[model samples]
Target: MNLSHPHSSGTIVRCRRLLEPALREVVSGLHPWGARMVAFAMGWAGLDGREQDADGGKGLRPAITMLSAEAVGGTAEDALPAAVAVELVHAFSLAHDDIIDRDELRRHRATLWKAYGVGPALLTGDALLALAVSRLAARPEAMPYLSAALIELVQGQTADMAFENRPWSGPDVVTIEEYAEMAAGKTGGLLGAAAATGVALGGAPELADRMWTMGRDLGVAFQIVDDVLGIWGDPRLTGKPVHNDLRRDKKTLPVLAALASGGPAARELAAVLATGAADEESVRRAAHLVEEAGGREKARALADRYLDSALGVLDECLPEATELRDVCHSLVDRVS
Candidate 1:
C-alpha cells in the first residue's frame, strides 16, 4: 500500500510529465483571465499569479489512463489525449464541486471559488470542461465514454445534493445501496472514462467496457475511503477541517452506516445527528459514535470489497499491469 513505491511512483511521474505539457497547451487556449484562474485551480500558481509548489492532486486519473494503455501494449503517448482529458475533467469537477458544497478549502489551500469569485470560478470550470471535450472531440472511439461520464457526474451530484433533504432515518433515509449508486456515478464516472478511453485509444477497444466497470468499482471504494478520512483523518494531511462533512450534513458513508447498526451506539448517534447542531463537541461525539458502532470497520470492509472487485477485472483483462494494480490499491489505502 506504499503509494510512493518506486514502480508506481515512476509510472505516475512519467505519465504526469507527458500530461503536463499537453494540459498546459490546452489550458493556454483560454483568455488570460480564465487562464490565470485555471492555473490557480490546477495548483500551477497562486492567486497572485506566481508559481507555487501546491498540492495539485495525485494525478491518479491520468496515471490510470496511461497505464491502461501501456497494459494493453500501447505506449503511454498513445493515450496522452485521453490522459489530459480526464485530468481536465477532474479539475473541472473539483472547481464546481467546491462551489456546490460551499467548501472554502481544498488541497491545503483556498478553493477556486474562494480565491476567485464564484462566477469566475464557475466559468473557469466550464472553460476547463470545454477544453476537455475538445481534446477528444474527434476521437470517436473515446468520446462516448467521456460524454457518459459527464452525464453520470451530473446525475450523481444532483442525487448527492438531494440527499441532504432526506431524513436521517426511517423509510425515506438514504440507503447504502443508494449511496453506492451515487458514489459510482459522482466519483466513479470520470475514473471509468479514464480507463475506458485509455483502452479504447490503446488499440484494445474491446476491453474498454470491462475497464470502465473496473474504474466504477474502484471509484466507489475511493469515495468510501474519502468519507472515512473526512471524519477522522488529520487535517494536516487531508487539508480539510475535522468534522466538516458532519457540519455540512453531508450524507457520508460512515455516518449512514453508523446509523443503520440499530444498536445502542447507533441510537445515540441518531439522536446526536437529529439535533442538527454542528458544534465541535457534537460533531466529535458523532464521530466517536460512528466508530463505536463499527461504521469505520464496515466502511473499510466495503472499500476492500470494491477494490478487490476492481482488481479482479484488472487481473482478468491485463494481468501484466502490476503497476496499475498498485496504483488502484493505493487509491483506497490513501490517507489523504
Candidate 2:
C-alpha cells in the first residue's frame, strides 16, 4: 500500500537520475531481443506500465546497489547492471503481491491483474523474475552474489505464503518476535539479497552477508511503517482505504497488540476482526477501541524498536559503509 506522505520525492528523483539509463543500457546490452520480449510480457511496453509499477517505488534496491558499490570503492555506474536486476526482482514481487492481496489499485490505477487480468499478471511476474536472473548472469562480476540472493528471495516468498495459509496455528495475537520473523522473510529477504549482491559486485564477499543483514533490518523497519500506514494512513496519500487491513482480517502489529491488551476495546476489536461483522460505524468504534486499549502506542513503539535494531545492525555489519549506512538511516528515519 502507498503510504500517504512518507515517500521522499527528492530521494526518488536522485534514484531515477542514477538508475534509469543504467537499467535501460544493461537490458539492451544483455540479450537485446529477449529483454524487450520479457518487458512486453511484464507490461513494461511503455511509459504507463513502467511508471505504474517500477517508476514509483522507493528505490530501496537501487539505493542498496549504489551504496554497496561506493562502500567497496566502486563507482555507482559500475553497479548499474546489478541495480537493474534488483529492481526487476522487486517489481516481480509487487506484481504477485497485489494479486495475492487482492488489491485492485496500484499507483492509483488498476493493478496488472485487474488491468490485463490474472493470467497475464502471473506470466509477467515470472518473466520479470527470469529477466532479473538474466541481468545478473550477463554481468560476470555480480553472478555469485546474485545467485544466493535469488535463493533467499524465493524462499522468503514461500515463507510468506505459509504464514498467510497456516499461520503457525498459534494464538491470533501476533507477537513482536513472530512478526519480526515473518517480516524478515517477506521484506528482509529481498532487501538483504539486494544489499549483499551489491557488496559482492564490489568484490567484497567478506562483507556481502553483513550488507544483506543490514538491508534486512532496514526492511523490517520499513514493513512496520507499512503496517502502521495500512491501518491509520490517509486514504488520499496511500491509495488504500482506512481499515483495508482490518477488512482482510490480516494480522498487523497494532491489531495484534490491541488483541493482547485485555480490555473492552481490545475485546471488541478482536470480535470484529475475527468475524468481520462490523458496519461502517462498527469499524470506527473498533478503531477507537483499539486506541483506548493502547494498540496505537504499542505499534509506534514497535516500529521504533525495529528502526533502532536496523541502525545497530548497520553500524556493526558495515563498519566502513558510509553510503550504505546513510541510505539505511534515511529509509528508517522517514516521516512522510
Candidate 3:
C-alpha cells in the first residue's frame, strides 16, 4: 500500500473514450428538460442548459465492467451495454448523494442541487435511475444483478443517513465493521454487479460469479482509499477541500477506526465530534488525532488486504488479467 505509487491517467482516459458516447446517447433519450438536468448533473451541460466541455467522472464502474469482460476473453464491445448501464447507475447515486450530503460541489463545479435547486436535482437523479434500468431491459439477464445491487445501494444509503443522526437523537456509536459493511453495500454492490453482468453477457457465467467477488473487494478497497483522500487529499487533485470529511463529521472508515481505538487521541477526537459542529482548526486537529491514534494505518492496511484478496481472486479466475489488475492498482494508488 505505497501511497507514493505514481498516479497514471492512461486507463481512465481510455475508459472515457470507450464509454462517453454511449453515456451521452442514453441521456439524450430522456425528455428534453430532464435530459438537460441529468446532463448537468453529469458535467455535460451547464446550469444554463448549454453543453459544456468540462470533464465528467472517472468512469470507474464502467471501466471495471469492460476490463472484467476483457479479462474473461470478451471484447469491450461485447460488454458495452452493461458498462453504460452501470455508469448511469453510478451517476444516479452521486446526484442523490450530493443532495443528501448537502454537498455544494463535484468535479470542481457546483453540485446540481446548488445550481438548479433540490427538486430538479432529485428528479434528475430519478430520471437517470429509470434510464439505467430501461437501458438494460432488452437484456433480461442483466436485470437480476442490477436489481439486487440497487437494493443493496439503497440499504447502504439508508444506513449511512441513520448513522449520522444516531448520536444526538438516538443511541449507539457507529462501529468500524458497520462502516465497512455500509461501504460494501454503497460501493461494492454496484461494482460486483457490473463485473457479473459484463462477463455473463460476454458468454461466461462461471467466470462472472467469481469476478463478482473480485469486483466487490476492489470496490470496498476503492471506498477506503476515498475515505483517506477525504481527509488528506490535496484540493488541487481531489477537487475537495482539506479535511473535508473531518469538517462534516462524516463517519468514514478512518474516523470510525480512530473512535474504535479508545486511545487518548481517540478520546480527543470523540470530544471534538460530540459537538457535531467542527470548525476548521478542530478539523485539522481531528486529522492529526486520527493519524496519531493509528486510524490511518489501520484503514490503509484494510484497504491493502481487500485489494490483495481481489488480486488473488483474479489470479485464480483469469491468470492473464493484467489489464484488470492494472486498473485496480491504479485505483488503489490514485491521488484523487
Candidate 4:
C-alpha cells in the first residue's frame, strides 16, 4: 500500500508537473551518448533509446527548492535555476553511487553502470556534474553555495566508503556523532545549498542563512528516514530486494545504533555482520536483533528530532511555510 499524506499529495503532484519540463529540457541538451546514458539512468529512455514517460522519483529536492523560494515570498519561477541545478547534481551522485555500491538496479530498472559499461557510466556522471555546475553560471550569486555543498558531498561520500572497510567489532569503530556528520555532509549539504540559493533568488538575501539551517536539518531527517526504509521498507515500495542494506552490509544509522548498544542483541548483530555475507536468514535475524536492541526506535526518534528542529526553523523564518512543512513531514513519513 502507498503511504498516505493527504495534505501534501496535491502539492507534490503540482510541483512535479511544474518541475518535469525544466528537467527534461536540461537533459535533452547533453551530447548524444551522454544524453542517452543519463536518460536511461533517469528512466526517461530505454536502453535502445526509445522515449519513456518514466516516474523519475518524487522530485523532492527540486520541489523543496521551489517551495523555499515561495516560502520567502517569491514565485516558484524565481528558483527554477537552483531547482534544476540541484536536480542535476542529485542525478550525478546517483549515477556514481550505483557504481560504488555495485547496485544493478535503481528505481526498479538496470543501473547505468549495469546497462552501459562502467567507463561510460562514470563519464556520464561526470558530464552530469559538469552540467549541474554550468547551469548555475547564469546565476552567479548561487555559485558559492553550490561549490561549498559539492565539496561537502564529496567528503561525505568518501567517509561513507571508508566506513565500510572498518571492522564491525573493532575498536576503531564508527560513532553516532561521526555518522551524523557524514549524514549532514552526504545528504544535507546540497539541501542547504538548495534552500540558500532559493532564498537568494527570492530576494531575501538576509534569510538565506536561516534557510540553510532548515535545509540541513531536513536533509538529516531525510537520510534517517531513508536508513529506516533501507532496513524495514517493503521491496515493492522501495524497488530493491528485501533486507537490502543488511545484504550489502551498509553502515546505516540503524545498524550503527544497534552496534553501539553493546547489549546481547547488539553483540549478536555485530557477530552476524562480521560473517560478511548476509544471506536472507542472517539478514532477517540481524534486523530482528537491531529491533531487539531498540535501534529502530532510536533511529526514528532521531529522525523526528531533526524534523522538529527543521520545522521550528521554518516556522520562525517563514510563517507561510505551511506547504513546505507539509512536504517535509510527508518526506520524513515516507515508506519508499
Candidate 5:
C-alpha cells in the first residue's frame, strides 16, 4: 500500500515523461516574470529564478488523468491536455491556498505568497487558472467538467473559511457530513475534473460521469488522510509546520470527529481548541487528545470506505485498469 509501489512509481514516471514537454510549452507562453514565479511554484526553480531541486508535489492529479486515459484504451497523448490542465490548476490552487491560509511554507520552501508579495502570488494563481482554461478551450467535451470543478472548489473554500468562526461544539458546528461535502468540493472537484476530462478526451465520453464520481469519492478519502497528516505528520515529510491547521482553527476532520466522540479526551480537546490552540503546548495537547479520543482511527476507517467506493467504480467501469486502480489506492495510502 506504500505510495512507492513499483507499479505506481513506474506509472508516474511514464506519465511525467509524456507530460513535461507539453507543460513547459504551455508555461513558456507566460511573461518571463510570470514564468519565473511559476517555476518557483512548481519546484522547477528557486526564488532567484535559478533551477533547483525541490519538492513540487507528487503530481498525483496529472498521473490520474493519464492513467485514466490509458485505462480506457487510449494513448497517453490523448490525455496530455487534460493532464497539463489539471496540474496547472493544482498549482494555482496551492498558490492561492497558501495565501488564504497565510501559510509560509510549502514543499519545504517559502510559499509563493511568502517568497513573493501576496498581490503577485495572487496574480500568479490567476495566471495559472487562465492557462488551465486555455488548455481546454477547444475541447467542448471536457471543458464543462473543469469549469464545474472550479465553481465547486470556490464554494468549498468559502465553506471552509466560514467554518473558522463557528463554535467547536454546537448546532452550528461543522459536522462530518458537512466536512465530507466540503472535502468533496474543495479537494474532490479538481480530481473529478481530471478523471472526467481524461475519459472524455480518451475517447469514452460516456464513462466520464462515473469516473468523476469515482474521483470525488477518492478525493474525500484523500482529504481525510490529509487532515490526519496536517495534525500528526512529520514536518520534514509534509513540508510545513505541524499543527498549523489546528492553530488556524481550520475545521479538519480529525478535530471534528474527536469532538463528536463525547469522551473525556474529546472534552479536554474541545476545551483546549475553544481557547484557540495558538500556543505550542495547547496544539500538542489537542493533537494527542484527538488521537486518544479515537479520532485518528475513525478517520482512517472513513477514508477506507470512501476509497473502496471509488475503487468499486473503477472495478465496474474499467475492470482492465489495474494500474489506475493501484495508483488511486496508493494516493490514500501515502505517508507524506
Candidate 6:
C-alpha cells in the first residue's frame, strides 16, 4: 500500500470487523442452506471444499449486502439470509476461478484446484452452486430474484471462461471488448446481484434497478483497482507475481487503454501480448509497455470514474443509508 494512504489500514480493519462475524453466521448457520449443502456434496469431499470455503478471503459481497441493507433503513439481522446467499455464490466462483486460471494460491494458501486437482474443484464448485439454490428456495419470497442472480453469475463466468480460451491480448479492438465482457461477468454481475438482493431484502423493489446499476459500476471500479495492484502492488502484500495480469495477457483496462494510446508502450504491449502465455521475462517486458502506454494513469482514471458514478447513485438512491456513502468511498480509496 502507498504510505500516503494513512487511514487505509484502520478503515479496512473497521470494515472487516463489522462484516466478518455476520458472514460467519450466515455461512455457518446456512445463509442459504441449499448452497452450503452443495458445498458438502460427495464430490466436494475429494477437494477440501469445506476447508477452502471456511478459510476463504473477506466476505465482501455479503458484507456489501448487509451494509446496503442497513444503509437503506433495513436491519443487518434481516439481511443475514441474503448475505449467506451472496457469499455462497462468491465462494463457488473463487474455487472455479482457481481451476480455470490454473492458479495455485488464494488467500495466501493453496487454491482448491491446486490441492485437489481440477476435477475435485469442479465438483466442489457445483455443490456450492446447488447449495446456493437451496438457500434461495428457503426464502420463497426471495427465490425468484436470488435464483435469477445465480443464473446471471453463471452466465458471467461462462463469458469469462470463453474469453480466456481466445488467443489475443493488449488494446487491440477485439481484445478490449473481450476483456470488458469478461470482467462484466467475472466481477460486475455478482455485485449487481448483491445490490439488487439488498433492495429486495429491504422491501424496496422500486429501487432494485438503481442499486443494480450502482453495483455494476462499483464492480467495474473494483476490478480496475484490482488489476492495478496485480501489476504494480507490493509482492508481500498481494502475494502474487508482480505483474500476473500482464503475464496472462489479461487485457485489463489499463493495458487496453495503453494499447489504445498507439504509443511506443502500446507497440511493446501489443508485441508481448501478441506472444501469449508469457514467462517472467515477457511479463516484465509487458509491464514496461503498460508504463510506456500511460496505462497506470488511465486505469486510475477509469476506476475513479465508475466509483464517482456509483457514489452519485448512492447519494440519490440510498439517501437513508448515508453512512454507506463514506464506506464505499473507502473501498475505492483503500489500497489492497
Q: After superposition, how far is residue 211 of candidate 2 from its true place, in Å?
A: 1.4
In candidate 1, stretches whose alpha carbon ends up further than 4 angstroms from where it belongs are 1-7
Candidate with more favorable, higher lDDT: 1 or 2: 1
Query: Which segments of candidate 2 are over 4 A away from where they belong?
Result: 1-12, 25-55, 138-173, 317-323
Q: How would you encode candidate 1's per-residue C-alpha lDDT over 128-160 as one tens digit per residue?
A: 999999999999999999999999999999999
lDDT of 6 by residue, 1-336 (tens): 232344334533454565555544444543444334333431222233453433344456766676777766776656666766777777788778777777786544567667766787687677666656665676655566566566666776676556555544433354555555556556776777777777778676677777777877887787888888888877666655567666664557777778778876687677778787377788877777787789889888988988999889988987766455655665566556
TM-score of each: 0.98, 0.82, 0.93, 0.95, 0.98, 0.81
Q: Residue-wise lDDT of candidate 5 within 66-114, one digit each (tens)?
A: 8888888887799999999999999999999999989898878999999
Better of 4 and 5 by TM-score: 5
The residue-by-residue lDDT of candidate 2 on 116-187, one tens digit each, is 678777776777777678877766656666666667656655655554543312464446677677777678
Candidate 6 worst ten-residue window by lDDT: 39-48
Error of 5 at 190 (Å): 0.8
Predicted structure 2: lDDT: 0.67
lDDT of each: 0.91, 0.67, 0.80, 0.84, 0.91, 0.66
Superposition error at 245 for model 1 (Å): 0.9
Clash pairs of candidate 4? none
Residues 210-298 of candidate 3: C-alpha lDDT, one tens digit per residue: 77777778778989999998888777777756676666657888888887788889888888777764677777788888899888998
**Residue 76, candidate 6: how far off, in angstroms?**
0.5
User: After TM-score superposition, what is the CA distance of residue 170 in candidate 4 from its true location, in Å?
Assistant: 4.5
lDDT for 70 in candidate 5 is 84
- Please give the range of 10 consecutive residues that has the lowest summed lDDT in model 1: 1-10
lDDT leaderboard ranking: 1, 5, 4, 3, 2, 6
